[model samples]
Target: MKLQVTGSISELLTGISHLSEELNFTIGSDGYPISVVKRPGPIEVKNANGQGEICFEKKIHFYRALGLWLQNFEKSKEFHIVEHPQFETSGVMIDASRNAVLTTDGIQMLLRKMAVMGLNLAMLYTEDTYEVPEYPYFGYMRGRYSEIEIKICDDYAEELGIEMIPCIQTLAHLKEALKWNYSNEFRDTESILLAGEPKTYEFLRTIIKSATKPYRSNRIHIGMDEAHELGLGKYLELNGYHNRFEIMNQHLKQVIHITEDLDLKPMIWSDMYFRLASKVGNYYDKDATIPEEIIKMIPNVQMVYWDYYHTEESHYEKMLTMHKLLVDEPIFAGGLWTWNGIAPNYGKAFRTTEAALKANKKFGIKEVFATMWGDNGAETPIQTVLPGMQLYAEYTYHQEVGPEHLAERFEFCTGYHLEDFLLLNHFDETPGVMKDNLYESNPSKFLLWQDILIGLYDKNIEGFPIAQHYEKLIQPLHDAKGKNHDMNLLFHFYEELARVLSVKAELGINLKNAYDQADKDAVHACSEKLSSLRKDVEKLRLAHKKLWFSTNKPFGWEVLDIRYGGLLTRIHSAEERVQEWLDDPTVRIEELEAERLFYNGIYTFGEEGTLGRNLYHRIVSNSVFSD
Candidate 1:
């Protein structure tokens, strides 16, 4: 399906070359009468008999129009597509701070896909994952992108018609940034910097200067969200008790002054304002109200209303109205569900993106981007969220998107089936999991990481054939891997993960049940299963290790190494205990004898009868994980 073009698309040739594997057809640039023309309106692709032109106003839209041109023409179908973009700016922000920073080449690979998907911006969310010149400990050994690495990525993105903006935390969420002994003097608590300290402002100025120097865009995301302990720590010791709102505003004013000095336009997370307005400090409290005086004092920075948990359009509309109360039109930041646990939760991502984007369209949000955060050590591969990315990219140009259309568009642009990428969602959407409870319940994570002897979530998931669920998922992921050779490494990780979870999901339940009944034969069988489970876990770890190194930096791999090592050691100890119990009935199996309580730790949504949990610390044990 090679198409010859009449006009030169030399500017996009570099990016297209980078994305050669995903392209189904070759372009000669001189033979096909299909030309590119700059128009003043919506992007249009008119293809009839493999000869037509792509009309687009913006440079990025040209690439997007080309995607439209190929979507139908490559499949031997005529296409006359017109796209009116709903948002002025549509893109994605990658969370690179949580131990899984993508290599420079990987960022380029993603940028190429973004160009074809009609996405125009990318934010590298690096809390402490980028370098600061003066401070050696600043992002030291955390796989922080050097200034050169960022410059290279920026150049690559620029060639692809994508704006790579610098997004960093100016205040709070800096626990990793200030974890070392060198940063102790400026810490308000563990993560929050002192609000008014001269040294704190100095640190902020240096880090802010370091963060934005590599990017061409003047737009920056200055994160000031989730600073729950704003003035309760050393800030109180330095300057007596003050209202949290006053402290926040004063700190914000100082930070804004720095951005203004740098000639940068900034946006801060709108959650802190909403959280402070509520009595219970909930960001989504419908009854929350902010005082008019405080709104006036807010500096002239764009408010980013990032809502990812809602399923209804009305919820987004309410929050958007609240943001408009502060500014005329706030930039909406929705999420693609890559942050949950071991797998991406597409059930939640699709539902929430559809609802949130609809609200954004109604509210006339000019700019919108989807956030793909890597929470909880970033266990899930970022590649698993391609379908979620397509969901956001599709909503940018069309008011209504059909399922078949999205699937076809994704397959054409990515060379991977939407249904196969979607099959990865079943890794988390097992039995006892309902659509109403998708984000909170990461059965794929907790069940895999849950202790064998302790049985933390075993009782809640009891009587459901959850083990059979993972067993059924293996071959489909295998088939998907065969079809998606480009991302087969990612598919292999999930396939092995399903293999491990299939056996380990109910291992503790079986062992504990037998121990309670004093069934010695069943206990012996559990010991043999433990030996095989260790091998399965090792296989899963190796599979994940291969995927991580191929896609990410080597620094964060150590954290997961510790997690896998802990699980293996714990399983080995469980085997020894079972053998000891089998050797002598007098020596009781104390761990299995304890009556399992209905447990839902406070780390996650502690709903009644819900087995949802995330975070490695909570999954590993009931005791304190680290000091």
Candidate 2:
């Protein structure tokens, strides 16, 4: 079908159609391409004289074409898709409830980003970001959205062919409002309700009324996720209330009523709807699933199926099932593919988005939303994923970007864009450094090495299992106890190993300097430094070898199952080993003391001797012990 060429919509689609032959779809006057349900009967294409009902039992080609077209359009020069289209809805939800209230300029920037990605909807979840004078808390940043700011953002979104849907928390994620001392009316209890008193219908009504005043968009998203204390003691105290589901439904229905009164269609997270679905029949003998009850109670209401880990295979299946249930109602599949890092997980996000698109076709899902969650903190640098989001727009709208094209785009998106940003790991700068090595190691020394590398990276090193492998190395050292006569060997082993590592650090700086200098002498100096560092590393290796010789076979046969000891017993073993060393008569007490001090040093001062007390004092203690 040929799109009626008019305004930005025409330009956007025209640029898209130019990129591929399969992007033959047309945007109607209603704002987007009219998605007809694929069936086995006869069909007609507008102006093209094409007629036939296309049966899509498994029309993978057609679905793929649609996804490819989206991907192409995103990469086109006229516009960009800011987020991966398939993973998330073209809908953006901002948590204005938090401290980062939406500034007018920020909202505009978001709109530009969304428009470039072909997004059509936005959900501004606010406690009091925008306020209206009549409503007292509408558009509540300090008071609410001034009529002008609200009009500006809304109109701007409309101009970009996007809709702004205001969101207010009916149940939870309403800390700001509660902090405003307005929670006693809504929160059922203090502990259960963080920012307010207790959850009730009245407070929800006020929030809804306050939030939905400015927007022309009929749709609204009433957030009800993360309500840990769903039913407070007083709520459960109700004579007939047996479960939390009934209480939630009652509050939900009230929200629906409020939305209806405002002539607005309400949308909500499917989480509460799913959680309370089982309890609905038990609570009030009513259909509780939002999709199931759509035609009955709130026919006009839409549901968003949001999954942050959309890259997981299971999540793709879950969304498909959810789409089937919510077929008639507008189901927006929301996916999250970026977090905690500066770069987006392009590979995972792409795969997830592809799955979502495929599912959209399979389960008749019409809308998609890409979500950015502020979980770690606001300083998470979400802007890092903007390029990836744009790539999503491209891939979803258009099928492909060759290596060279993607590389150029990446450079545009990220200042230092490489060719395969999607395939690259986050810390691509450093090589062979794995995470997860710190905790699992038994002796704690090898784990200490992993910790040193992590400090250099200055990033979250929590998930890496590098320490587990280091644990294997620890076993040999631990087993070597009682095999050696010279206790001084162990002391020197650690001290020299540390000194060698320090030399490696110095050599690293010298190598960098040599590269900058680009002179023959500088090159020679770099080579010398590298050679010296290598020798030091060899020395460290020799020290470790000696340590192994002293310890390995002595206690090798005392094999005990660590699991049988439990966590506490395992911890006690380390302390016991230290005690055993202290108690040994043949060992020089001073040398044992010196090693103990070094062990402590390893803990406090990293492998590089950064952050520790004076080494002089520790040596003095050793000398005193020896004398």
**Candidate 1 lDDT, tens digit per residue, 427-481?**
7777877754444588889888889999888887898898899999999998988
TM-score, model 2 to reference: 0.51
Poorest stretch of ten by lDDT in candidate 2: 555-564
RMSD of each: 1.6, 18.8
Candidate 1 residue pairs in backbone clash:
4-32, 5-32
Off by over 4 Å in 2: 1-89, 132-147, 189-199, 238-241, 276-300, 312-315, 336-338, 341-348, 399-627
For candidate 2, the lDDT comes to 0.43
Query: What is the TM-score of each predicted model, taking all chains together?
Result: 0.97, 0.51
lDDT of 2 by residue, 408-439 (tens): 54443223344223322221111123121111
